[model samples]
Target: MESLFHPTGNQHILDRIDKLTPIKLSEWGVMTVSQMMEHCKMPLQVVYGTKHIKVNPLIKLLFGRRAKKQFTSAHPFGKGMPTAKEFKVNFEPDFETAKRELKELVEKFSREGKEGIKVTDHPLFGKMTYEEIDVAQWKHLDHHLKQFGV
Candidate 1:
């Protein structure tokens, strides 16, 4: 897996972010390019321990493995996939600001390295290791970048 912790892989993500424009079109989903950028930050925050969202025990027990598999698999996330409520962006977002924030968060994650990531149960993916978080984060950003054809 291409981890954001890897310098080249990290630059790949930042480059994609740089390629986005306020008027960029999405190949799928309802988010404007800016909204998608903001939405993408949610996972980083969650993994960084800056955001805490509780996962219902039953939901995690029933769907965690399946969700984890889908997220971390080589296949791109299918169009119009469901998002956790916390990750949803409702208002118009400033394109540059959103892009900058996402880029900063990505860099912060890379600096933290594997051991720096605090182990926590993902809101849906259950308990995840730093390696799992690395793969999941990269895949999530890649999916959105591809969504906007970046």
Candidate 2:
């Protein structure tokens, strides 16, 4: 699995991200291109500790591992998957700004490495190791990038 912590993996994601344009159309899901860019920032915000997701213990116990496996697995996320409320981009976002911010966040995530990542519990997938988080993040970016047909 590719990881954001590795330079090559980070560059691969960045290259994919650069392919996105304001007029890009999603092959699936409800987000506009700009909204999708903004939506992409949510997970990084969580990693950076700017966003705190409260995980319900019951939910984690019931679904965490399953959810984690889905995200970290080689198989891609199916189209029109359910999104968490916090990840829903509700407002209009400036395309250029959203793109720039997401790119910066991706760069920051790559530069941070393991020591910079926060050890936080995912809302649906309990406590995760840095490696798991890395796989999940890359898979997420790949999934969305593919969604936009980039």
Candidate 3:
């Protein structure tokens, strides 16, 4: 599993993020460049503070095991994360700001280390540990980065 807290992994993603431009386009999903950046920042938003979260009991029962694998494995994420109502960034956000936010959040995670890592009630995954948080952060970012050939 790639730890964003590690220098190499952090550098890898940071470098990729730095390379992003408004001209970038995804190879798979339909998100615009701005939306993609907003998406990249979602996990961080969840960690730093809640923008929006909605986890219910049935959701926890269904997604709990899947969430566990995400914490410790190199498995690719399923298409589309469970989005929170508050995290949607749909106003044609500024590309420069999105890029900056993405880099900043990742850096915060790197600086925080494992102790810094923590997950709360996901809108779907219920109670998540930092382990679960790391995988989702990495996997989701990786998927989108690859989508844009970053």
* Predicted structure with the largest lDDT when compared to the true one: 1
Q: List the residue pairs that clash in candidate 1.
A: none
Candidate 3 collision pairs: none
lDDT of 3 by residue, 70-147 (tens): 644777866765555556666788999888888988888888776554456566666677766777788878888988
lDDT digits (tens) for residues 67-129 of candidate 1: 998887777787888988878899999999999999999988767677557656777887777
Q: Which regions of candidate 3 deviate over 4 angstroms?
A: 67-72, 78-87, 118-123
| Candidate with more favorable, higher lDDT: 1 or 2 | 1
Which is the winner by lDDT between candidate 2 and candidate 3?
Answer: 2
Scanning candidate 3 in windows of ten residues, the lowest lDDT window is 115-124
Q: Order the candidates by TM-score, highest first.
A: 1, 2, 3
Alpha-carbon TM-score of each model against the true structure: 0.93, 0.93, 0.82
What RMSD, rounded to one decimal, does every model reach?
Answer: 1.3, 1.3, 2.5
**Of models 2 and 3, which has the larger TM-score?**
2
Error of 2 at 119 (Å): 2.8
For the record, the alpha-carbon RMSD of candidate 3 to the native fold, in angstroms, is: 2.5
